[model samples]
Target: MKQRTKARSVALQVLYECDLTQHTPGQALEQRLAEEHLEPELAEFSRQIVFGVYPIVDKLDRYIAQHAPEWPLDQISVIDRNILRIALWEFAVAGCTPVKVAINEAIELAKTFGSDSTPRFVNGVLGSLANRLDEIRQQFQREKAQEEGLSPRTT
Candidate 1:
């Protein structure tokens, strides 16, 4: 496995623990990395993803909720939700990992750690999410403009 993918899976396991334990994701990640046998770069990358994503769970949840409203956050499997969190963090926020890589990695993770139905469901959600990515991105841009009260320019 690629170092980042390994790190991300570790990070996701931490996220899964957080979901199961109700501890903060950052706290969970810190605890895991402090004790785990990971290289320095891997540790940092894992920390980056966990900390990078921890603060934005609500926003991520809302985005997933919008795209897959039929699957409530609570109803979504833990593995699938964390996969989405990782991919969405990479796609929507981190911008470090490419969207295609994120989706592929997520599908692989789902297959490995998720329920039998999770692979397809993960693929479905991520694929659908990818389809609307530009639209969703535009939605964010528009909202940011509205928040900043910046009017659109017209020549």
Candidate 2:
């Protein structure tokens, strides 16, 4: 697997564990890192994905739920939900990845980790959300600004 993809997989595993158990994301990530040796950059990327997604999971879920109304957040499989969260975070919150790249990476992750229908489900939901990615990113930016006590800059 590609290093970054591997990192995402690690992040997904940590997220999946945290979602289903009482384990803290930090502890789960630490354990995963210890088990698999990743290069420094890849490890940091994994950390970024976990830490980025964990804090705003509710927001991501709301967005996902909006797009995938048929599949409520609780009803979505753990792996699939986390995959969506990771891709959403990468493009919308972190703004470090292109929308297409994020969506494609998410589909790949779904293929590897999810059930038979997972890839299609993920692609469908993300395709619906793609039209409004900019809007979602701006909303998240404004919310972050509000939380940080800064004026939200209009783009």
TM-scores for all predictions: 0.83, 0.96
Residue-wise C-alpha lDDT for candidate 1, range 1-155, written one tens digit per residue: 77777898889989889878878777787788877778999998888888877766787788888778778889998778989988987876667887888999998888889989888887788877788877666665665577789975433
Off by over 4 Å in 1: 138-155
Cα miss at 15, model 2 (Å)?
0.5
Instruction: Give residue 119's lDDT in candidate 2 (0 to 100).
Output: 95
Task: Choose the strongest candidate by TM-score.
Answer: 2
Task: Give one digit per residue, the lDDT tens place, for model 2 in 1-155.
Answer: 88889999999999999999999999999999999899989999999999999999999999999999878788999999999999989988898898899999999999999999999999999888878987998889889999999998765
Native-referenced Cα lDDT, model 2 = 0.93
